[model samples]
Target: MGASIDERKPMVSGFGYASHSSSGIGSAHFRGRGRSHAPFKTWIWRHWPLLMVGSFGAFYLIHRLSHMGSSTSAPKATSQSAQQLRSDSSRVQNGKVRLSDLIGASIHLSEVAAHEITDVKFGGKEATEVKGKTDEGVDEPVTLADARSNSVFVNGLRELFPGISILSEETDPDLEEVGISAINGVELTHDPWLDLNDILITVDPLDATKEFTENLLHFVTTMVCVVHKGKPIAGIINEPFVKDEAAVWGVALDKATEGADLRVSHGLQPSTEDTVAGADKVVISRSHTGSGADVVSEYLPGKQPVFAGGSGYKALRVLEGDANAYVHVTKIKSWDVCAADAVVHAAGGEFTNLKGERLVYEKDDPMISGGIIAAADSKMHAWYVEKLAPLQSSHGDKHRI
Candidate 1:
């Protein structure tokens, strides 16, 4: 189950101080030492005001010394350490590495994996052997590509931000062992605002695995999303099969505006249009199309349904204005949609559940119940939600609008 909007609130920022204890001589030690205290009392009576001033001056000096030590030592620390100890604490509390840098790494690694997968000769032995089934019972083609890509991303992220937990779809035995080793090598910095355990990174190294196997390269993508306490804060989607090798990323902390124009680095401008006409196109999953097709057809009437593979690719179609909306009425994993969700939201679109609630990532169970909807604009999203209410209410009676 996904977290509610109230449960997805931003975490509070603060550092916790560890407590320590020390043993000391009790008051009984002074009880027998009264003869020595008499001389000290006589001396204090003779110069009480001087002793008082000296005590106050010493206290002030110690206080100043403590502050000076902190100021002087802070700058001398390494950049990573300084960032970890920032006063605001919340800025980089999740990790010292920048989100943009992480996204860049994800794109590069995904592209490398894509090249390996697509370069194989078509209709060859290697191409036929790529198909495999995952524990989830989904036909996961491109096992080699998925393993290599998972290794690259998992190792790269572990090296970049050690101690951050990663929840990835590719859990092959070899990859899991390598990832565990990589995680063990990380030396994490303490953060008060963020629990490293609570910061999860979800990855779909090769989305649209079946499409990639079928040589429908354009529909495949590599996705990475950063979830902080169940909420997605940053993400990257890399379309490695595209001619230009396009990659786009977005940060939720940037305060993305609804229906705002987004100009990405790949020359893709996501539409900000708030209305969809009857002729507009709707993208639906090619592999899991059934009721989703019916709903799209019923809602938009004459709008054509564009069959596409990969949740990321479908969401990208909506973001790129190739499709006015994308709808799915099946259970999808967090990694399958989180990265695309971030990109769509940043691109002035809304990606939410059929109940009109935002999706939450990094839960113990990565499965997202209910269905999902992605629209080019908020108004269209609301319209889809209104239309889907009846289906949602009848679908297992599990979803609430």
Candidate 2:
């Protein structure tokens, strides 16, 4: 049969054909006039492995570049972090002076006063006679030790904190020059007034003047307290007669002051047991026996009373665990107890009025009319307060010695 006109036209196939037949299917075609178009399956089969290798290499290169970028910029990020930390540190330093520096300076001044006082022979020809009044409104004999100690503390602290106001038992203007000259050799590097408010410092140069005059060295202490608004923020009690060289110092837990090392390093842990039920050791004034002693004895039935000479010494007994608590019903001078109060309170103990209220220090009159109580811990303090409540009620609004 002869091919028709339709069969003469070319048909599309895998390869371009010069001539084609419309009826042909799956038959060998004529050679293409230009390039051949291979089947898609055959092309993929020939180049599959090469394509995968190229794609993997490109991906690896991109990953390496990303990691390199991060590594190169690491130093800049670290530098910025370091700068932020430094700024935070500077702000904290500007806020307040270290508590250790204040305590150290106070101890140094106290030691100087102690040396001067110890050198003077009590009741000897060289002893200078002076007199002072107690919180009980009684005249007591004061000595050169009291005056010299007062001068050292007042002048040394003034030099230490130039801007802060100072209140001392020795207010003689005539002694100011002598006091300033006495502490001429003291050198302090820290500025206590840097970030402080209008601070008031109360000083009892010799806490137990009568005891100091009687050569009862154990009772004598050089005391200083830092008062802000109406509260004591920091304080020091230095017992010169102790065999070992140590002083008790503490800052209020809520105050911005730093440096826990300034406090009693070894004996900071207070007694945890109920003082009235456990040790039941109570400290009272040796010279001034107040009515509270009987009340305390009745409350803690079998507890023994331990008589002590100085307010600082009695408070020290509680701090050292020699006595579980110290109770004083008589009127007390603020400076007489303020320093000890700070130390006890800082050591996780309590120091408050007999009525279980906190004591305030920024008063025009330095005398504390209410009785004071110090215990190993707040739990013990509460027990004592509960026991003493009836006595307080019987005595009316104010209890007197």
Candidate 3:
């Protein structure tokens, strides 16, 4: 009785003793019979550390996720910024072109190095003024010292043009210097050109210097012309010794006369003196050619054929409207065409190869040649080609870009 009372006293002190025995834990029927998924008291003891660790892990995962998101977004933002910058640059370039009729206000290439005396650094020992032949047969390379003289012009143009690429008989720098895109500002380009836009200046600075020295014709100086789209727009051939006694003119495309300059403005109206395709004018070269000139004779019968030295001087007389077309049957590279081409293009004219295809600038090859055909007006060009088409195709269209 005393012992039972002692056990009963312990039970009463704890509110009550549990009725289930230790065996109750093993019975399947007793499992989860009357309890929640987890009772507060037992769960607290068994999983306190697990709950704390899980809470910290969830917070760390969220924080790490945010940092990762920021990292991924950074490059995308940078790419978008670059795109916007490029778009803005394009707009600026287009605006510059639209606001003005000319790329720059009246760029007369003749004024840049127009009358500079061309030193005779070369004279082709084999340069012949007679009939010759090419791939089509009987074509001739000017075979003169034009190559050595090409170096001085190449160097001079580099000085004059600054960062623009050079295309001469002696050197052919790629257009990569100006960037592939024309719409991009030259200021932004790795290299800036003396003339902007697609305009490329070409010159055969001393075409017939050897012929001039040997022939004693004093009417030759540096050849000056701008070749655009592989054609002459405006050209100036200054007789270095003559002191501004040179001719400057170019063909007029649409609106060529709209923004008139002192030179072409006077030429817009055909003066009795500057008229081409007329009588009483002489077409000649100081370095004479019979076959090439014969082709010209068919167009201008009995027109006096004058002999002028230097390629620029010969081509210039045509620009002045003092003469008709000058046909170069030799292989002329970029340098031979660029200077006069720039001026001619500005003057609103077109220059082309004998095939009537446009002349392109900056070729990799230096020695390549196709014949050149210079005309006064772009519209009148086809008429001349109609006359020369036979010469172009029959001669194998050897015109190079």
TM-scores across all candidates?
0.64, 0.65, 0.46
Least well predicted 10-residue stretch by lDDT in candidate 3: 9-18
- Which residue pairs clash in candidate 1? none
Q: What does candidate 1 score on TM?
A: 0.64
lDDT (0-100) at residue 19 of candidate 3?
A: 29
Count clashing pairs, candidate 1.
0
Best-to-worst ranking by TM-score: 2, 1, 3
Residue range 177-228, candidate 2, lDDT tens digits: 2122222222223234435444567888877777776667788888888776
User: On a 0 to 100 scale, what is the lDDT of residue 238 in model 1?
Assistant: 82
Which residue window of length 10 is worst by lDDT in model 1?
A: 182-191
lDDT score for candidate 1 against the true structure: 0.63
Q: Model 1: per-residue lDDT, tens digit, 206-279?
A: 88878877778888888888776687756788877677755677655432321223323233577756453422
